[model samples]
Target: MSQLYASLFYQNEVTEIFSDRALVSYMIEAEVALAKAQAQVGVIPESAAIAISNIASTALDQLDFDALAVATGLAGNIAIPFVKQLTAIVKQNDEDAARYVHWGATSQDILDTACILQCRAAMTHVEALIHQCYRTALAQAEQYRSQVMIGRTWLQQGLPITLGHKLARWASAFRRDLARIDAMKARVFTAQLGGAVGSLASLQAQGTAVVQAFAAQLQLSVPSCTWHGERDRIVEVASVLAIVTGSLGKMARDWSLMMQTEIAEVFEPAAKGRGGSSTMPHKRNPVAAASVLAAANRVPVLMSSLYQSMVQEHERSLGGWHAEWLALPEIFQLCAGALERTLEVLQGMQVNAENMQRNLECTQGLIMAEAVMMALAPHLGRLQAHHVVEAACKTAVEKGVHLKEVMTELDQVKAYFSAVQISEIFKPESYLGNIQDQIDAVLQEAKGEAK
Candidate 1:
């Protein structure tokens, strides 16, 4: 039932990557690669390696996930039953090949390598989606480069800022996420080929050679040491993923607030029955924003489990490693879902420049009081100007009149500025200090980073 929203959050590519069939198929690929590597180092027969590789393609559908689940519960891991099923299948083609199946590799070695392959595939899809989202963000920043809106702090209007200022921030976050993913991949996508207790004592003289050959066959990097006990590399990927989802949540949060009926400064692009309430006809909800925000809210708690699972017992752990097996894939799935939804939102977003202008004006010139304060600061002391404007703002709120009008009548304000000068400071457009310069600088910086 929870899968009802799977299509809304994730895509077919994500399903294919983490599917049961793909999982076994990857494990089999690891087995075949290990056999081939052993043969390369003369630990197994070349003919047996060829036989295992030839038979592995048809072995995917034969796996019984139900049996594997029961075995996993009894044995404390899935790799035990999975390797048994793999060996049984390979034995039908050549008994000699079956003898060498998973030779010198422990269950952790095969399982960890398979999980890395899965992550490699998942990251490919996620990176493509992130790149798409980043490009859309870049387009929004450029299109709305001078689109003006009120900047808010603590849910209240503070000053006038360009829409590009906000969108460029989104662009920069996703751009940096790409680098985090790459750095994590370099550390985590390496081979995990240590035998029992990470010593490879079974392989002995051929251990490092088999490890190198396995990495070469899989096109993954060779690790400096086995990571059975050190889980930080994988945790780094999960942490980066959490941060990416958090960034998406922030972007959605700002846009969702702007879509409010009272604000109406921006909106999710509307379509027939999209974001419709069952009872209400006028609702155009920010559905993507809600999904991304939910992912953001949930990922941190799940990531915490991954971090807690880092404290393993010396060579192996009783419950900690199993915790990671549960959490890491879930972290990937949640982040992938958020990335997919955010990409859709950014590509189809609607911006209302007129509504932004109205909202800025709705504040009755109080939003521009900071500009007036600065103007007065040149003549009066900065603190004194702040006091004068603060009093005028309170008076405007009390009388329900514009702050600019109240300020003109104030003696302290009249002591410095003329009518035209007071009006200039009140205009929201006049208060855009360095928004264009900031936008230009960010866009230029994003261009280099995106490349």
Candidate 2:
């Protein structure tokens, strides 16, 4: 374990979700559930189910990896070696019971259901961390909704906007992700059970009953069909995870830009010996953003592989089903790490309301040009007001004076209103049009999602 890459990509909590031990544990869980399900329907002896369940609870360390590596590679799946070991272990306790260890299930059934168990565990972690981002962003938005800042478009400051509005936009993406995860839980948690091909011909009359019992034991939704070759549920989970990572990447991108020494509109939380420059002592980098962006860049490739691999050969697949074995775990690991790191970024983020104000001022009243045009619009026609403001902006810049001050010399502005209105136009507070209402609606919707 390179603690460095582990530190970077695999948070201790998330890495555990995709750990070798967890894989074996979940596969054993599926096998035991299958044994119980079969026993309930008389396909397997009750004594055999008890014996297999008892042995399946053995420690992960007791499993022989050297034998499993060669055996599973030949068998093309983990459940084959796992069931082999499980049945042998059960034989030690009850020789007759060992015959029913795996009952009528195929390798894909146990493996697929085991993978779903891992997904449920990994998603549980992802969901908690995402909720952290949503709540933190909500508070920041609500706190700063009226706090004026420079609103930039295409990397150029175009108008005055509240910090709350910017934070609310970030929060909105997480809301959709949260809803997606909730909805996907239904689609992705269904159990996969088919013997050899899509038909449970091995189990004959008892297949459906055993599958229902198996799903009940695992607390997973029962599949409508065998789904041995159908992998859309897996694809759907990966697709939603891609959206989640992409959204986190966007948040990181925004924070990274804002953390620029020149921008300094926000800062990732500062800590001792953290985000420090090894060579230059004066730097505090947005390191969390780097990890998030990297995950964002890499996850789509894995997701695309899943999409391409969805076209499996009839009933079973050649390399297509095999392709999913490693890709799905990696997708979960990378995306889970991104969620965790992003949650850290949001929780510790330093909002520089002062810097926001300073950046808004750096525009030298040009950001308020729209405000001036609109206020003058009611008095003068819209086209005339735009032309007047355009000329006034040029004069203000050329003379190195404020836009409000330069407007005093223009007769078009003087004819429209008093000096007070011109001064008000230059103030950011005068131009926040409906931002409060917009932000309020977002906050309200966020609360609704919480319910």
Candidate 3:
């Protein structure tokens, strides 16, 4: 089925990788490799392996896709029809070779391994995109390390922080995502080669050898045993992808909020016709963030289906295993789209540092209430200091005067500090406790990850 909004949610390269043709190709590759591996272990004649391999070269052209599609509907899975067509193609060249075509493998073996092949290739691109995002975020973090901005809690200004600190947090997330992908490679990229019902019953004596050789044939790892009933590996891949998509979504939400008209501290990268409102002439939207947010919202829901699908009947799943077919590919496609959109946003994201600094003062010095309270806490009791600052804050708000102006007029404040000290208390930079250190720690960690 074709999606109307596929272009908005999937990158062309990713779509190609998970296309029907690619799945067919991967399945064919699995079949050919299986034949060769069996031959290596003396399970099949070398002539059979060679003939099957030779026919596989042009097997795609020889097979009828239209007929295969119709057959798939009746068979309930593509592997059965695919193997039938492959065996028939091999028979035309050498009848004897066709006998060993799929020798001791089941439909799930080829299908699962083929899907693994597709996922292995797809994740390479995902890992690269994440690295690009990590690099871009780190660069931004370094560039804006000292650029002061307001930190919000409960959607209102709470404290002071540097823009670099914010970007570093983003970079840090991508860095961990990279680690997760790397760690999962060993578990996810393993071959699925149990003959039938997670046992090599058909290939009995040489089962272990064939399993090892089959995995080696495709340059995939050999799992300790078959994963036909063990769906954790597949679920783990979905889980990590959910985390990555969630991170991108979070960044998008933050960026979109920053781009709000009243709080224009950041803007999406500008291009002709990009992020423009269709009806509103003065609107500049966060288009990239919108795409990412869409992916973020959808990927998790898809992941849930995969989690639910983990309950296989016994050795092979009925509907449970089948549930993964569409959901996993769609998850990959969505993540690809989200990652690409994130790259575009991060690489050219516009920072309104002036607006950031200006907005910090919009609260009329009330943002600096903590600094003043802490300064007086040493002279008065903590409660007394808090009570005095709380009253001054209310007066500042009611009179429409700055917190510093009200603080200077308070007798308690006057007795403890000079006018110059009172002025310093309201400076956003003065109260940025350890922001540079925190940003430095994030940068150092990112640099370590790069190595």
Best by lDDT: 3
lDDT for every model? 0.86, 0.85, 0.90
**How do these models rank on lDDT, best leading?**
3, 1, 2
Cα lDDT tens digits, model 3, 344-403, are 889999999889988998999988999999999999989999999999999999999988
User: If scored against the real structure, what TM-score would every candidate get?
Assistant: 0.96, 0.96, 0.97
Candidate 3 Cα deviation (angstroms), residue 358: 2.2
Off by over 4 Å in 3: 1-4
Off by over 4 Å in 1: 449-451
Tens digits of per-residue lDDT, candidate 1, 1-451, equal: 0579787665677667777778788889999899899999999999999999888878887777889989988988888998898889888878888898888888888888998899899889889989998888888989997888999999988899888888887887888999888877778788899999988999888888999999999999999888898888778878988999898889889989998999988888788868889999888898888888988998899898989988998986778888877777777787888888888778888888889989888979989888999999988999998998999999999999999899999888898889998888787778788877877876787777748
Q: Write the per-residue lDDT of candidate 2 for residues 359-411, one digit (tens) a residue.
A: 98885888888888888898788998899999989998998888888886788
Weakest lDDT window of 10 consecutive positions for candidate 3? 1-10
Cα deviation of 26, candidate 1, in Å: 1.2
